[model samples]
Target chain A: MTVKSKHVRIKGIKDGLVFLLDDKCPFEDLLSELRYKLEHSHQNILTGPIVHVDIKLGSRIVTEEDKEAVLEILKSQGNLLIRSIDALEAPGSKENDEALFLMSGMLRSGQVLHHQGNLLFLGDVNPGGTITCSGDIYILGALRGMAHAGVEGNEEAIIAASLLSPTQLRIADIISRPPDEWGTRESSMEFAYLTNGAMQIDKIHNIVKLRQGLNVFKGV
Target chain B: MGEAIVVTSGKGGVGKTTTTANIGTALALQGKKVCLVDTDIGLRNLDVVMGLENRIIYDLVDVAEGRCRLNQALVKDKRFDELYMLPAAQTKDKTSVTPEQVRDIILELKKEYEYILIDCPAGIEHGFRNAISGADKAIVVTTPEHAAVRDADRIIGLLEQSHVESPKLVVNRIRPGLVKSGDMLDIEDILQVLNIDLIGIVPDDELVIKAANSGEPTVMNPDSAAAIAYRNIARRILGDAVPLMQLDRKPGAFSKLKKFFGMG
Candidate 1:
């Protein structure tokens, strides 16, 4: 009977989580090992809201009651829901998980906030201030300065703000208009997205149709 | 120890020297011992504005270079006995006195005066950094123009990162008529960009030029609108609550219509 952290590897997906279970181990041993690792939360994650999870059993045969046992173990530790039990790893689940950074307080003139992944800022960015993110940029407050999203050439990245009045905005390799041209001063929440290799501004509510797989959770 | 306040404006000709001279004089008039240090070095004007240029035996560089003592370098104001001026050298460039020397001079002045108002030179160069190095607080001066306000914003960012407390704003040379006609940037427009507490707003007054021509600070002129505005700023510095003086100049053509009807 062997139970290691590798037997129950947790991989993060785009909007959900994937759990890869070891196949060589005995059924009862794997269950006990999964229970032990989850009970301790080796990764120390998933204490937040209920997260959707997909289980991958590598060439292992398991009954419905055995799958229920695995679910019961994960459910006791935190809010986690098992979406599926497959024989192989899900596609596109191998990408390294990029965290979503959240920060409060406004950025004054000449101040800049840079993050590797997605950024969710809770304050304004005054003129001469800037925010650069490799992934998506979501600002809950006014953005009056420059914001460069997808700095690592991820063109799919979007920049959203409550008040979308920026001096300049850049998505991947594309740079938009100057202050006068970009000065729409939208009163409502809006987001700037790249479509057809051109940047466009729209209401925040339309983000669902803009990005696919972004509408992961529906009717909730 | 006295509180040293550095008056700075990133853009030139926005009234940094004028603000410092008047605020120092106004503080002296309140019976608080005040010293004004002109860090402009080559383009020394605070001394000229305060009518203390003639009395300067040694300037700031002389004091820093060990050619003269602090008392010998400071020019005593003619009108106010409690006010003094540390004139900048007329010949040397800004690099003559280092920031360390400026801090040392300020540390020494702190023991004797209630307030030390440092007149920072224009631009965010060596002189600007030296002026704010030892100050406890900062006052950013700018006119109601896009360029001036933009430069002031940059200066505020640098000051906030320095040892000094958050800098206050003073929108100098505001023209109410121009602002009313939407030609000039109003106080709110400037404040929105600067994003700092406003210490005062000095209206564009011809008397300020008249006073500067004679090497006299405008704060000494009781009837001048700019003088009153400067006085109110000095009061605010002393923790006194002074309402902002109305920007409508009484002698102006538009103001006369409102004044005659008692509606202004």
Candidate 2:
């Protein structure tokens, strides 16, 4: 049952293109329409200047497969970006570069952040929430949640937090939790990494020197 | 405008129907036009629990398949004039209704009623998806147990992936005695694992069965502890900040004798 006839308006925003859809249409139909629009409007997919496609669902509930389809379509564009429904609410775009994305609000339980570059949070990563990144993850607030860096298998990834108490922390293949003696304590910045074939944490300020020390130790 | 709220529990026998009945009754008592839609399909129990089984002329499957209008399937409640029930089909299966049909029905209902409470089927399959498709918000009903909590965690993850924001949690069948004795999981433990906002905690009460059997929800009786909890939950949904009620323990013989003897 392919329900077509859905209207999708595509326009150029600063960062990328915005695809505003009719609220009543099914998400799958919208994605199909988006594909049709791109193929018809640009004549060639590779030459399009659209760097991202921000979908404004507008109170419509989207299915998981529909979301995956949209992601898949955007993935084909190579540099095309896709963001969450919340991200499209403001309707602006920026260049895709290696930069930090700082989320200033509370990452409530069950919320997830999946990014390829560095991620910084100024709020608590509550329990049941997750942060997955290819680069490093820095939480300026409490990190009493889950954090996975080097999701693409970069072993040099590090996760740092002001209050480094997480349910689980992973860097590449190494996964670890705080020691049993560790309890709720005063907030302090701590950096975590795969050290000596295990996950270890140390004061963030001493990380640079520690890396240098590790190099010197390897030389010896 | 009315909002459809689906009460779902991924695991069976976890009080999804009980929550739906009580919350629907409570909302009706508040003078809101409410409809409790049972989406369980073949294993339908909401009609029996709501005491409207005798009145179901057309089930939800019939409505979805265009066999009947939405109004013809809606069974009016015996107790409250504003409360109604849309029972599921016993012969047909869950596949009879699609998520699109549910969404269309809810959108139409929103223009007429004040609240739509959907009694969801157990499991995270098509039935569950159809129940939640039309809902504006969701109430995940889970008991304080390891298996239930784990299933709830999975449901929460699924809801998040589906973009259902701020789905509240209701912990049902809590036994304060067992919790005090450390034999059962506490509310805090469930909250720590599920990490969702606690909506209500219904104590384990034998009266729930009696109420369900009678087709009269516990929320109708002020004396029933489960009913009181359900009422408080309904009020909380309306943005009321009612304090949680402390569950009363059965008094021991020593306390009864002390009272009878009029001793300090």
Q: Which numbered prediction scores highest in lDDT against the true structure? A: 1
Q: Give per-residue CA lDDT, model 1, range B1-264, as digits (tens).
A: 999999998999999988999899999988999999999989999878887777779989999999989998888889988899898999999998899999999999999999999999999889998899889999999999988887887788788779999899999998889999999999988887777899999988888998988988888988677888999999999999999878765556567556435687
Q: Where is model 1 more than 4 Å wrong at Cα?
A: A1-98, A178-186, A215-220, B248-264
Query: Could you give me the TM-score of model 2 versus the true structure?
Result: 0.65
Query: Which digits, one per residue and each the tens of the lDDT, describe model 2 over residues B1-264?
Result: 888898987889999998999999998888889999898999999988888888889988888889999998889999999988888999988888899998888788888789999888988899988988998888999998877876777687777667456789999999888999999999887876677798899998888998999988889877677888999999998899998877645565456436434573
How good is the docking of model 2, by CAPRI class?
incorrect
Interface RMSD of 1: 1.6
The total number of steric clashes, by the backbone 3 Å criterion, in model 1 comes to 0
| Tens-digit per-residue lDDT, A165-207, candidate 2 | 8889999888887655344455579988876757777788778
Positional deviation of B24 in candidate 1, in angstroms?
0.9
Number of backbone-clashing residue pairs for each candidate, in the order shown? 0, 1
Candidate 1 root-mean-square deviation in Å: 11.0
- B232 in model 2: Cα distance from truth in Å? 1.8
Cα error of candidate 1 at position B54, Å: 2.0
Clashing pairs in 1: none
**Candidate 2: which pairs clash?**
A15-A93
